[model samples]
Target: MPQKFVLRAAAIAAASALILAGAAGSASAHVTVSSPDAKPGGYAKLVFRVPTESDNASTTKLVVSLPKDHPFAHVGAQVKDGWKVVKTTEKLPQAVKVGDVTLSEAITTVTWTAAAGGVPPNDFDEFALSVGKLPEGVDSLNFPAVQTYSDGEVVKWEELAKDGADKPEHPAPTLKLVTAVTPVAASTEVDNPDTLARVLGGAGLLLGLIGLGLGLRAGRTRKATP
Candidate 1:
């Protein structure tokens, strides 16, 4: 009987660990950035994936901060149903230049408020942004976000993890700008990378056509001169 009890206890402990591992990697995991086209000096579709970790409270609001060190010239939010998104702008302490364009103000924070039903406990949602002229200086951008729950609980996702295994308790969502880097996979309520790929492909095609036209024009000019 003693041996049987020990075996049963060990099996239960293993099962619990599996459940936690699954949660940590899935629907109840950290808030993350899903960027398919995050190359430097290009426009990108950035999606913020928010998961409600609370067991009893519903997530009602989210506030994401855009760092000033790495700034974007333009920022816009994707419209999501059942949620109201507000982009808040603040005057920069110092004027920053972006590709010959000077700006005095910038969007510093984005907030999403639940309109109807907030994200229930253990459920997740996604918020998106369309930002242009991503800075070419940095290889990555960090976004610090806050999650508010209906039960008067606030969780801040702002830790900057050094590595995957050494991740802090609440690691902030980060987007890697290098095009070659493979992003970590996530499950549920994230933007589709295929849609972003199509948009970028169309842009590439347009540029190619423009280049071809310019080349042909130059050739014609040379022949006419001779």
Candidate 2:
């Protein structure tokens, strides 16, 4: 009975370890955005970090799908050495502004293709770009990306939620942005002015009343006893 109990305990421990390992793998597979919050009417430098699989194959290409309805959809990317960059443009219904400039069309997609053996196993790369003149009313920006492996397998990261939920199966690149608001100024005038004035005024009034009462009592005592 003792030996049987020990064997059953070992089997349970092994199953627990396998479950934990699978959870860790799923957590590590999501592609993440590194920079540039999507803000309206702002200029930002955006970066997407790509991690290749740790086992055998390296990442060969990264394709980022830009949002069609973004105010600054006409996007351009900074070129990287030894990597081929491609940009595809699309039309927009409205124009966005950055400072004093107005922008109409924007780039819809950007792709970065690595040279042969550029990204190796257990390594990573960053795709960066200079973008500006984002429109004013977006809370978050989502980029669904396609990551290609050397063996022709593709991983899609493109799940977004309105309620900000995380998708365990496929995750997309995201950026949270905040708009600038006016700040309140500190007041220097009336921290304790009313309290100080009331205390002093009440003390003076009480002393005057006490003096009058004492004078009347003294007169009455003199008149009755002398």
Candidate 3:
């Protein structure tokens, strides 16, 4: 093999490694909102995915702030083991009619403190909330969150996306409210792109090895003949 080819291959490998590392980092950088049954003027179960980026610390608590402007008629956290849920409510500035009766107050904040082993390092957990009658005429809703690590580090995922600019490093979890859409998988992990990428990468590598083996066998046979 030529020295130039070897150097080029080394450089290419380094570049590919960097690219994959960046992709993997971005995939689990911040919290995300996912829901398969989210639609306007309907009850939807929103699941917030929280991935612990820390290497040695676990996530101890999560605080999610709900929008006060367009208050949902109801908001309730689904029961999850190993977590203590706390919800706070306050009087609304102005009364709004939901169906027949007017609402006086709404849940403003929801905090979940880990009771057991919290989220382990390099792992993720999902918190589900059942909120009803999502406001219409809105494309999406933003849920700002505060993540607390066991190492006394706090990360605020609350930056809204700016137009015509690069994405924020810690973007708030945003859920799109659609009027119509096809059915999707119940589990958000099934739709994870990272898993798809890993599967494809493995398959491609296997095929490449097989092709290299066939080429070497052919070259050896040709040299052994004449």
Candidate 4:
């Protein structure tokens, strides 16, 4: 009987562990930026992966706005089928030089509209861009994006993450820029504190489950030893 009790408790612990891990993954399963480690005064490929969040409507459009203060001197987007890409450039307040070339205007916004079919439910799409000369002395860059649904609903992802505060409901996608040597440090700096807490909490829960299982086994053994 004690052995059976131990096995059942082990099964429950495994199930609980799976649930905790799934929740941790789900927390980060939103719009995200996947790119190479960018350095100051360097170029990197910026790719945004967007998942369709609405169940009733398909994703029809995506609009990404770049930061004005730290503008990229050169920005270009990759071509994707079934999507019409549009880039809008605007003159900067002051001209900036890049590799002996003076740039008065820079790409500010990139929008992608569905050419024929939209991203259906449970689907995702990636948009790529080449950006050069990331602003120096900045830890990260936030690209505020807007997702448009076929049903005319607009979802904005522009909230910034603040320390010691709850994560925003619609957090904007951010790309971390690191220097040549301190790449690991940059990653550590970007780790969300809440995420660390969640991981530790999950570990604690698993340990507690194991302890409970052991206690149950002991109790069953005591009862059987009449």
Per-model TM-score on C-alpha atoms: 0.68, 0.61, 0.70, 0.72
Clashes of 1: 0
lDDT of 2 by residue, 49-148 (tens): 8878656887888899876666453366868777888998767677755456665776878999876675677677788866766656677788889999
lDDT by residue (tens digit), candidate 4, 101-192: 67788888999999877888767889999988777778889999999989998989999999999989888999888765646655773376
Cα lDDT of model 3 by residue, 60-159, tens digit: 9999998887777889997789999999999999987765557889888899999978999988999999987787788999999999999999999999
Candidate achieving higher lDDT, 1 or 3? 3
In the range 126-158, model 1's lDDT, one tens digit per residue, is 889998778887878999999999988899999
- Which pairs in model 4 have colliding backbones? none
Question: Which of the two, 3 or 4, has more lDDT?
Answer: 3
Between candidates 1 and 2, the TM-score winner? 1
Number of clashing pairs per prediction, in order: 0, 7, 0, 0
**Ranked candidates (TM-score, high to low):** 4, 3, 1, 2
Best by TM-score: 4
